[model samples]
Target: MKKFIALVSVFAAVLLVGCAPEVGSDKWCENMKNKEKGDWTANEVRDFAKHCVFK
Candidate 1:
C-alpha cells in the first residue's frame, strides 16, 4: 500500500510537470530557458529544441 501510494504520487508529479505551457508560447520558452540544463530529461531537451530554440 505504501509503495502504491508513492508510485501514484510520483506519477502525479510527472503528469503535472508535463503540463507545461504550450510549446512556442512565451511562458514555455521562458521555462525552457530557465530550467537547468543538467536537470533536463531527453524529452525536455527535445521539446526545447523543437519549440523554444527553433522558434
Candidate 2:
C-alpha cells in the first residue's frame, strides 16, 4: 500500500509539471504581443505567462 501511494504521488507530480506552459513558444509570443505595450519588465512578462497563459 505504501509503495502504491508513493508511485501515485510521483506520477501526479510529473503530470502537473509536464502540463505547465513552457517559456519562449508561440503561446508566450502571443501573450507578449497582446500585453499592454509600455516598458514592461521581464519579471512581469514571466508572471503573466505563468498565471494567464499557463492557467
Candidate 3:
C-alpha cells in the first residue's frame, strides 16, 4: 500500500506539471501556435490571440 501511494503521488505531480504552463511565456505561446484551433477552449483561444500574437 505504501509503495502504491508513493507511485500515485509521483504520477499526480507529473500531471500537475504538465497542466500548468505560464501564460504568455515563450513555451506557452509556442504551444498555442502549434495546437489546432479546436484543441483550445474559447477563453484559451482568446487569451492566445491577445497575448501570444505579434503584429
Candidate 4:
C-alpha cells in the first residue's frame, strides 16, 4: 500500500509539473491577465498565439 501511494504521488507531481504554463512568454502574460479578469480558459489561451500581435 505504501509503495502504491508513493507511485501515485509521484505520478500526480509529474502531471502537475507538466501542466504548468511556460512563464515570461507573451502567452503566459496573457493567461495571467485573463485569470485576473476571470476570463481565463485553457482553450482560449491556446488560441491566443493565432491572434497574437507579436507575430
Error of 2 at 47 (Å): 9.5
Model 2 steric clash total? 0
lDDT of 4 by residue, 1-55 (tens): 9999999999999999888676546766676666654575676555554455435
Q: Return the TM-score for each candidate structure.
A: 0.55, 0.44, 0.59, 0.47
1-55: candidate 3 lDDT, tens digit per residue: 9999999999999999988788878788888888898889988877887787741
Q: Measured by TM-score, how close is model 1 to the native structure?
A: 0.55
Top-down TM-score ranking = 3, 1, 4, 2
lDDT of 1 by residue, 1-55 (tens): 9999999999999999799688678898798788888998888888888887776
- Pairs in clash, predicted candidate 1: none
Instruction: Kindly report which residue stretches of model 3 are placed more than 4 angstroms away from their true locations once superposed.
Output: 1-15
Backbone clash pairs for candidate 4 read none
Tell me model 3's lDDT, rounded to 2 decimals.
Answer: 0.85
Q: Model 4 scores what on Cα lDDT?
A: 0.67
Which runs of model 2 end up more than 4 angstroms from their true locations?
A: 25-55
lDDT for position 31 in model 3: 86
Clashes (candidate 1)? 0
Clashing residue pairs in candidate 3 are none
Candidate 1 runs further than 4 Å off: 1-19
Over the full model, what C-alpha lDDT does candidate 1 score relative to the true structure? Answer: 0.86
